[model samples]
Target chain A: MSAQSEFDREIALDAADGEPGTYRGQLGEGWRIGGGINGGLLLALAGHALRRELGETSADGIPGHSDPMAISAYYLTPGVPGAVTVRTDTVRRGRAVSTGQASLVQEDETGREVERVRVLATYGDLAAVDGDATTTATPPQLPDPEACVSAAQAPPQFLKHATLLERLDLRLDPATTGWAVGKPSGNGVIRGWFRMADGREPDPLLLLLAVDALPPVAFELGLPGWTPTLELTAHVRCRPAPGWLRVNLTSRTLSGGYLEEDAEVWDSEGRLVALSRQLARATSPRR
Target chain B: MSAQSEFDREIALDAADGEPGTYRGQLGEGWRIGGGINGGLLLALAGHALRRELGETSADGIPGHSDPMAISAYYLTPGVPGAVTVRTDTVRRGRAVSTGQASLVQEDETGREVERVRVLATYGDLAAVDGDATTTATPPQLPDPEACVSAAQAPPQFLKHATLLERLDLRLDPATTGWAVGKPSGNGVIRGWFRMADGREPDPLLLLLAVDALPPVAFELGLPGWTPTLELTAHVRCRPAPGWLRVNLTSRTLSGGYLEEDAEVWDSEGRLVALSRQLARATSPRR
Candidate 1:
């Protein structure tokens, strides 16, 4: 596939480090491999690995894909100074889906094992994963992200910090009153429109990433800006290669400390492209 | 606090990526931009992010201290080619614990906007998440991983595939086969003892990653290898820092094309370190 070259050009270039390579990238700056590279950077690197594997590569002449819904990692050995190596392989592949695994390591200067990792990835047909495809109806009618007000729009004075809600383009279903994270998105939601500007206007990809970002609930209770989605699995039909994909996401908080959220991403005209579901450990500060 | 310097010295001054002045770490030769990195690496990165924000450095922090019970990720735009950036911050760092958030992205040629990612993370007095952290009382007696029939001994047909289980050093409590995966675990062990290698060898971090490696079973069909995880979550507690970790996983195959598994992890000494729960969309070609 044409994408293979793109994948190789992007990830392979930096594909060295265990002890030698330095953690690269901006988000990686926040991480302090010893002092700064953070967890978010590690995840981005992992995602980079995935894209490289799938970008131009396909299994059995078919592109192997996985809409990751959840992920868990253990920072075993910190990325040490020196040569680093990423070891990857297809754990298992199937007719509809495939799983790939990778490990990031900082070479051991003294011949000792440094860090290790194991991944469980799954790929499949879109129908089973996308609620939008299964939704026998249309998405709920709602205001545009531009016309909506921030639900958590109280003063920072009343709280302690700023949240993504403050940085997001939000719209709520009038029917939600605010409990709208997981209510039925009405009829066919042909599009999901989410835009997060990281300086200049956000691009379509950024918008999609933000739209497909962790559920709003994930950021609800923690400090100012904290929403970490360990893994993501999105299911789509005739997956869109849209110029601008708009996603309408909603979530439901369960009684136990669990929360379930689903999002329907669409093209501008109201054509549902995919469905995404996520589970998060919901926490609220004890008053 | 001293750990910070330890962490800093570990990854600082590494080689500048070919991009010049940037650090590079290999994930795999084939993975990169727009291609998603491996899930395990992403999680590790996220863990590193959380630790950085929590002011915990070194493996001693974040992934170093977690007993992961659950995790979820949302894949945004495919990772971009070349250096991705990641940003992480603490969500709620409370007395016994707190939560953190991480964001991963790839820079554009302009290095302006981030390409993708936002993660939600939680950290607490691990016990808090598992409300059931009381000690389990019994005459300590578990089926030695060595004594158990190796998945290798199963059959030639099942040989190649069980590579994962073969390396597992599963320790099942004799009174209840709680920590086993795939099969043979008996008793009302809502959970059981599981590990990749069966012995005194210690590899806690790798085991933490292993916890997420299990297939998300849709139904309790005793098929060969076809469990698709829809979602998974883990609540952590306390346990061995740099040693073997035990997984006590058990699942109930729901009739409606779904299955739910509950798992708990422990240290070699039997201290409860984490609790896990998961749901899966089970399907297969055989049964």
Candidate 2:
């Protein structure tokens, strides 16, 4: 619509010359959470490569199976901004759904290619997914977007390195931002509203990014520092409608030096759009 | 200790003659949900192979990284009871964790080996996992194992085909089993206690099976019939203390003919031992 949003530009892939299944992409700047790129952005990059490898049509010549229904990724190493390659492998091409695996590899300081993330995803037509539709989980109650605290208002030290916040309109619920001022709720829940700054409509692919867009829920537990995600799985339930999306992230248990964060995303129409769960290493605030 | 339990026997893998990464195993009878083997059993089989491939030691020669911390599986096809081969591939061997990929291949009716399940998992030492542990979610309230209705008391039609029930001591809370009597709770939840009939202790690998052992939560929503799992991810948080593990399954949303089932498994110590989330298709009862 407007020369492709920044998100599209960043995740764009060019066909590689040597391999049919390999594609080249660039990790754009301003997406670092700390020393590495955000995990969701890396997942979206691989999802893009997987979609390209699977093509727009299924083996049955049907126009379905074009969207990633569920994708699980394991972060092998932190990703740095630079040139990266995504290698895709088609596992199966069924009539109803198609499955593919993708790996995002980047070169290290020694010029050795290191795998940053490995993913397995299934693609399907969300529109064709018809049957009973019911929702027992409701959207988290929150004030209007304009009434919430903007990411720019976060602690300067945190906002300094998390430049990715500048690219999105992230408004945090004031109740959940207590940790920013040293008064955490201790409930391990983070609720916020997410929308791309460039006004791009969120699709299944973007939902991947939206699922992990929130700051680590551990922050709400007063356990600061970076909580690196080891593995994440996102399920795109349906296509979302345009407008700001409501996101709620919760950590039910924190045990064994690791915690599992679960996210539920609801679209403007109040319909659940995507759900995700990630396992991450828990870290305590620096003494 | 008594002899090996039925589960260990069914999931036992023998070294393949030729390849170093290949192993032979059999899908023992009784673990069938409908026409095929249970998804959890298949996952356990692959996890066993992954543990073998990654070995018991890490690259640092440390005696850790043996348990599966997180494992995700995609069900390719329904597996019948028969001989199956598990092909394992070591993706990486890090100091704290090791990653591996495995595929369970079985002979189809056409005599061609077809991949039944493809899994990507990361293994680590549960005992070595130490950190500031905190949990806000409490275990589900339910009657004692002896007070709950046993799997043997289920509808004869379902019990006849689900021989897997006989192998485990599954006692479902009466409130959530209304679908068996044509009175649906309309709230998608099922709580139960799980244990092996032979009194086998529950380990991380066994927790994989325990995660998906319960009947579909869709049953509580008046939905009947088989709910095949499309993708499942299980996270083992900590080791369990022997006895019956408390399992709670819930379906928060059923949209577009697909529903997500999230499970929280608490051990006898009341500690959260494992967490799992699965995507499955919802089916309505026959007219």
Highest DockQ scorer? 2
lDDT of 2 by residue, B1-287 (tens): 23378988988999899897899998878898765898899999999899888866655676546789999999889988999999998888887788888989998879998988889999888875542358888899999888898888888878777888888999999988898898879899999999998899998888999998888888888888788888999999988888999999998788888889999899888888888999988666533
- Give the per-residue Cα lDDT of candidate 2 at A197: 84
- Which regions of candidate 1 deviate over 4 angstroms? A1-24, A28-45, A56-90, A93-96, A102-120, A123-138, A150-192, A196-208, A211-215, A218-238, A241-287, B1-68, B71-287
lDDT of 1 by residue, B1-287 (tens): 12233122221223333432233322332211112433333444444445444545334343322433334433343443355445554433334344454555666677676434344455433433432322322223446655543333434543333333444444434334222244533232322345434333323224334455332222123433444444344444443444555555555323234444555556666555544455454455342
Report the C-alpha displacement of residue A10, candidate 1, in angstroms.
12
lDDT by residue (tens digit), candidate 2, A104-157 = 999998999999999998888797544236878888998999999898898888
Q: Candidate 2: TM-score?
A: 0.96
lDDT of 2: 0.87
DockQ for the candidates, in order: 0.04, 0.63
Residues A63-121, candidate 1, lDDT per residue (tens digit)? 55544333333333344334445555554444544445455555455776554322333
TM-score each candidate. 0.39, 0.96
Q: Is model 2 an incorrect, acceptable, medium or high docking prediction?
A: medium
Q: Give fnat (model 1).
A: 0.02
